[model samples]
Target chain A: MKLYDYILSGNCYKIRLFLSFLDINYETVPVDYYPGREHRFPDFLEINPLGQLPVLVDDEVKLRDAQAILIYLASKYDTSGRWYPRNPEAMGKIAMWLSFAGTEIMNSSNARLHDMLAYDLDADKARANAHAAFRILDDHLVEVGFAGQEWIAGTQPSIADVACFPYVALSRDGGIEHDDYPAIQSWLTRIQSLPRFIDMPGIHFMK
Target chain B: MSINFNKYHWFAFYASQQIMPAEIRARSMWNTDIAVWREENGSIHAWKNRCPHRGMRLSYGFIRGSQLVCLYHGWNYEGATAQCSYIPAQPNLKGPKTACVRDFACFEKHGLVWISTVAEAEKEPDFSDFGEAEQTIHFCRSIFVNESPGLVGEILKTSIFIPYGNDLADGAKLKIETSQAEHHQTGANYQAIWQSGRDKKKKTELTCQTEVRNNAILVNHYKDDQGNEGSLIFALLPIDDKKTGVHVLFSGDFSSQSLTSAKRHYAKWAKRMRWSIENRNLQTDSFNPWI
Candidate 1:
């Protein structure tokens, strides 16, 4: 397996973290997504017309989008069927939240780009939208906790947890604090404690 | 009797199954911040999220046994009353009476955790019409909408023929029997009866009651037919002026197939409703159903 990776990109980090959890060995083909803007270069554009980082190529299967890669990896590799449950209800939930992480959470990542990478955008509005998303997530997690389920989708952690984890854990980089969302804070701790969990630049292992 | 903070009846805020841990949870209703928590002994409490000591949100606090301790200053509040019990800063000095957090009346029934700003009235919002308490209750995931509860109510009243998809019998036709909206001093109630199936003898009757209280809407549904007799309740919580949280619960003697089908059906219906509410460009006039 080959991963077109960016060390600092949260989307890239989600793939890295999930791969580590599955104990899968994959060679990293580094993409300079930041200062060099290498993802937009001709070579990277050939791999993905969208020029998104974290493209996964496993044998004959080449995938774009972090969420798509996650579903593929979990379904193909995870024998336990815990990471991406096939049940209709759980799949529906995971799919809904994956869209949430891609769209609403990507807005927060845009705010992070403005703050950390000096990208030109309305950081305040992006932060506000991120906070709104966090509010909903925190409320939902509280209910999930009450139901004796520790993961995002079902009784176990699923790809939905992985998809939404990175941006929310690194929200502080975008000037979005998790202080107002205690349930999110607790959830981050739980995700950090998962076995074989790997850390990126912003998300750290829990003590 | 106007639709203010005090006139609203019991409003289901969260599912009972979701309040599993003994921790403080934050929620909003009609733009009012609320901190909901369950004690270790399984008692639930809802209070104003604001801390009286320093105006910090109590939802950011941690729970210790039966007390909620403020995150900022460690001002401990008892679970039931939300009265200040101990202050870490001034342990010897008794916590002042004025330091108590404003608490709301909370109750749990039919797999729902309800909170009300006012005292309980002579009679609670009736759920007895649904079913008995011991039946299996399936609580669906809540959906959030970027629309007012009144607007959602009007949409539901006017658009009664929305399909249930695979949840109904094959080739079943949905027909609205009676649609009525009665306005009270506090809020309004929209009631409608819908029947499905070409065979009138075996037609499934679905009765819907939507109560628009303050800024929230509660819809209770009763279904009776040859195959199933049960009820489903929906509680809409207004998080702010532009956002609403919807909680759903189903109670009845249901087969596993019907339960799974019901969950799938409502989840899609909610997504569609939310999209229509957010994108539709309709008249902004007051929701007067009589006209």
Candidate 2:
């Protein structure tokens, strides 16, 4: 298995973190996503048409999106069957959050891009959208806390948490603060406390 | 109303549980950056967020045993004295005494962590009204609101809370009454006399009182008709000119099942209260989201 990865990219870190958690031996094809912008080059675009940071190539299966890569990795490698459960209800909820992580939560990524990489994007709008998404996630976590559950989709840690964890944890890079979202803060701590957990550039190691 | 927290007074900015052991959290108040962390031995410390070495945010550092190791260059600061304990580059040389993060007076009480801006504090904020020794304390949540502490206090003066554990009816409006001040130096006391007056013909009065002690602590006591009572302590922390954080703790004799339910109920209420305050729907008077 070869994963095209970027050190600073949270999406790519999600794949790297999950691979470490699953104890899967995968070769990392480093991509100069920062100052070099190699992902946008023709050679990298051949690997992923969308020119994204993380493109997982495992034997014959090729995945483009980070969320899709997470689903694929968990379905194939997670022998414990707890990361991506087979239950229908759990799958539905996890899929919904995965969709949210790719769409709404990506606003935080865009904001970070604007701030850290000096990308020409609407940082204010991205921060506002990120705050809106954090509000929803925080409220959902509070509701789940009422049921005595910690993980996002279910009781156990799922790919949904991995998909959404990075951008929210790295929101401060885009000037987004977590002071208002106490529930989300607690959830981040719990995610960091998981076994085989790893940290990237912006996300601090809690334990 | 502007609150000058630069003086020597203990203000509770966060719940005790929020500061996990062996974890570093960045907290700010009155434009002063603070790094509040807990040791593995359960001892809590608050110091200036900046590292004396390179002005790096000490909050961004990690904890090793009782020391906060700076992320920039690995300068270890001791827990109790905030003195420089170790330097990774020069292993044998002792760090200078002046190379220390400025410390503050910190204490944990009533399920909340209190911090004093000055190093020497004559006394901690006395929350004698709650009598926490007699009741079980449950931290509800710490809510960050986009408003001044003074305005938040004013809103609390006339704010109406939802019923706790199906105690009051759904649409019953709880009216608030502002009583005379007990004393100014310590804090003002407002008797939040609420009347469930939705149905004017069948008016039911549910008594609840709020006490503002030490200009930071707001003690709210709610009693149901069936004698099921709970008190919520709102410890407000003024972050800056436009932001305030309210740490809430519930003290009552509740069963395990009822405790969780009551915490959920109050947590939702606190969230809605923040929404109301942020949206300008709540004010000193004429603010009733329940209606």
Candidate 3:
């Protein structure tokens, strides 16, 4: 497996974190997503036409989108069937949250890109949308917590949790503080506590 | 009901469990930004959010054992004294005495963490009304309101709490009447009477009593129709004039089986109260419910 990754990109870090959790050894093709802007180059564009930082190539399988890659990796590698469960209800819930992570939660990622990488985007709107998404997630977590469940989808950790972890953890870089989302903060701590969990530039190991 | 909103009173801000070890919670209370963290030994500390070395938010830092390490530079501050203990750059030298983070009075009580801006506070809020000595206090949730604490407190006085148990039916109209005509802005104290819908076949009435220990704690005692009693405690933390945090905790004889659903029920009530209070003005008959 070869992953086109950027150290600072939360989207790319999502893939890297899952790979580490699975304890899979893979090669990395580092992309200069920052000042170099190599992701926009012709060759990099050929790899992923979306100009995204993370493009995973696993043997003959090529995947884009962090959530989809998470699904593929979990289906292929996670023999334990805990990360991406085969249960119908569990898969449906996890897929719902995966979509949420890719769409609504990405606002935090956009805001971070605007602030950290000086991307030309409306950061205020992104932050506002990110807060709205965080509110929904925090409320859901609190509700589920009342039922004694820890992970986002089921009783166990799933790719949905991994899919949603990075941007929310890195929201501070975008000035979207987690102070208001106590449940989300607790969930982030749980994710950080997971076995073989790793951290990127903004998100650090709690230890 | 005269109470001081400025200082000397312990205000509950976050739920106790939210301040986990090895993590920092940044909060603002009484115009001061506080960085609250707990040591691995389970002792908690709240200090000025700014690091004396470079004004970096100490909350942005990480905790290593008994020390909070600044992110900008590896300046470690002792959790006990908030004093700069070590600097990686100056490994051979002891940190200067001036490099200390200002500490605040912080403690946990009644399932919530309370902080006092002043080093010495009057006393912790009294939770005897809820029988804290015997009953287990369950933290429902904390809601951040983009309004004044006074406003939130006023609204809470009239805020209806549906019984967590199967005591009250849906669409039951509840009206609140307070004994006092006017409540002081600093703190509140009043007795309330909650009357259920007159339309019900058997009208249920609850005499609600509120006790304010200090400027922040509001204990609402309720007796349901079935003679079961419960207490809803609201600890208001005035983050500033505009921003306020309301931490809700409930105490009752909840069986182990029913506790989880009870918590979920009250959490929904708290979130609804926040939404209504925040959007009361924009609410109209024509208001889009889906929006």
Candidate 4:
């Protein structure tokens, strides 16, 4: 297996983090997603039409999109069936969060791109939307915790947790403060405490 | 004005069990970053989190058995001395002594791990009261407060009143007998007494002592009523200038059932105190003179 990864990209980090949790060894092909813009070149576009990062190639299977790759890896590799459960209710809940990760979280990640990579965008509006999304997620997490559930989907941590983790954890890069969201901070801590968990550049281990 | 690091000569940074993981953990004290880790042999160490080479965070490094290896350059540091034992880039050459990571004086006692920035500090803080009843020590969940340690100390001096076990006999009353505050070079110390019941014929005594040592607070509780004796220790660690972490250690001669009740009561009390401290508008002038 080979992962086209960019260390600074939170979307790429999501797949890398999940692979680490699964203890699966795969070669990383570093993509210069910054000033170089290698992902847009013809060679990379052949692998991914969307010109996005974190394309995973396993034998005959080539998967795009971090969320899709997370589902595929958890479905095929996780013997415990906990990461991507087959139960319909669990899958529905997980799917909703996955879509939330792609839509609501991508707005926050775009702000990070503007700040860190100097990408031109309306950062203030992106940040405001990010905060709105975070408020909803934080309130949802508080309710879930009251129900004695720690993760986003079902009783155990599923791909839903992996999907939404990176952008939320790295929201500070976009000038988003998580100080007001105690539940989100606690959720970040719980994710860090998972066995075989790995951190990206901005996300450090919470003591 | 910069903080006097020596004021934290002997401070409790974390509970001993907190460093149980074999991987390196990160902690901050007075704005100084520290990398804490426990080796396979169960020995704990605290070092400056910055690697001597290129200033990479050592907490981001990995532990290879007992040696901590920096993730950036693979500089291996031995556990006890924090001396660079091997540099993978130069495997054949012996790593220079000066290449070692700076270490702090660390010692574990009474269920807490302490770190001192000053090297010549001869001994750890005298937690002898808690040490005397080692077998009964029970640690409560730590509380983190987003407030200055000094402000938290002031609040504790004036507003903190932890209740004794709820299982006290019927018609029993716990009243504060004496409250005394003293100032020391580092911080302040408060001592208080609580007398149970109005009847002088059958009286019970509860004594509480709190030591505010710079960025940390050490609390000791003692109860002597009808041949029942107990002790509890609460240690606070300053995570940074404005954030504080608190840990509780309870020791006493009480039945298991009573101990459970005491633990639950103190845990809730600690949470409430933390919430109050974090939410209160703390003014420097409002601090007690002694504190």
Native contacts, share recovered per candidate: 0.00, 0.41, 0.76, 0.00
DockQ of each: 0.15, 0.50, 0.77, 0.08
Q: Can you write out model 4's per-residue Cα lDDT over A49-137, one digit (the tens) per residue?
A: 99999899999999999999999999999999999889889989999999999999888898998899889999999998998788678
The parts of candidate 4 lying over 4 Å away from their true place are A1-8, A15-81, A84-115, A119-157, A164-207, B1-8, B131-135, B161-215, B220-232, B252-268, B282-291
Name the best candidate (by TM-score). Answer: 3
Give the number of colliding residue pairs in candidate 2. 0
Tens digits of per-residue lDDT, candidate 4, B1-291, equal: 112334546777765655555656666777788877888777889999999888988877777778888889999999977898998889998989888888998888766778887778746676555534455677654556678765555555443244454333334433443345554444334433333334435544444444444435455444444343454455666667787666766666557666656666666566556655654556332322111
DockQ-based CAPRI category assigned to the predicted complex of candidate 3: medium
Range of the 10 consecutive residues with the lowest summed lDDT in candidate 2 chain B: B180-189
Candidate whose DockQ is highest: 3
Q: What are the TM-scores, per candidate, against the unseen true structure? A: 0.63, 0.88, 0.90, 0.61
Model 1 misplaced regions, further than 4 Å = A1-104, A112-120, A124-160, A169-207, B1-8, B85-98, B119-123, B131-137, B157-230, B282-291
> What value does the lDDT take at residue A198 in candidate 3?
92
Alpha carbon lDDT of each predicted model: 0.72, 0.80, 0.81, 0.72
lDDT of 1 by residue, A1-207 (tens): 999999989999999999999999999999888788998989999999998888999999999999999999999999889898888988899999999999988878988999999999999999989988887787677556544567778778889999999999888789886645555766787798899999988776643
TM-score of candidate 3 on Cα atoms, chains taken together: 0.90
Candidate 3 chain A, run of 10 with poorest lDDT: A198-207
The residue-by-residue lDDT of candidate 3 on A115-144, one tens digit each, is: 988999999999999999999999999899
- Assess candidate 1 and give its TM-score to the true structure: 0.63
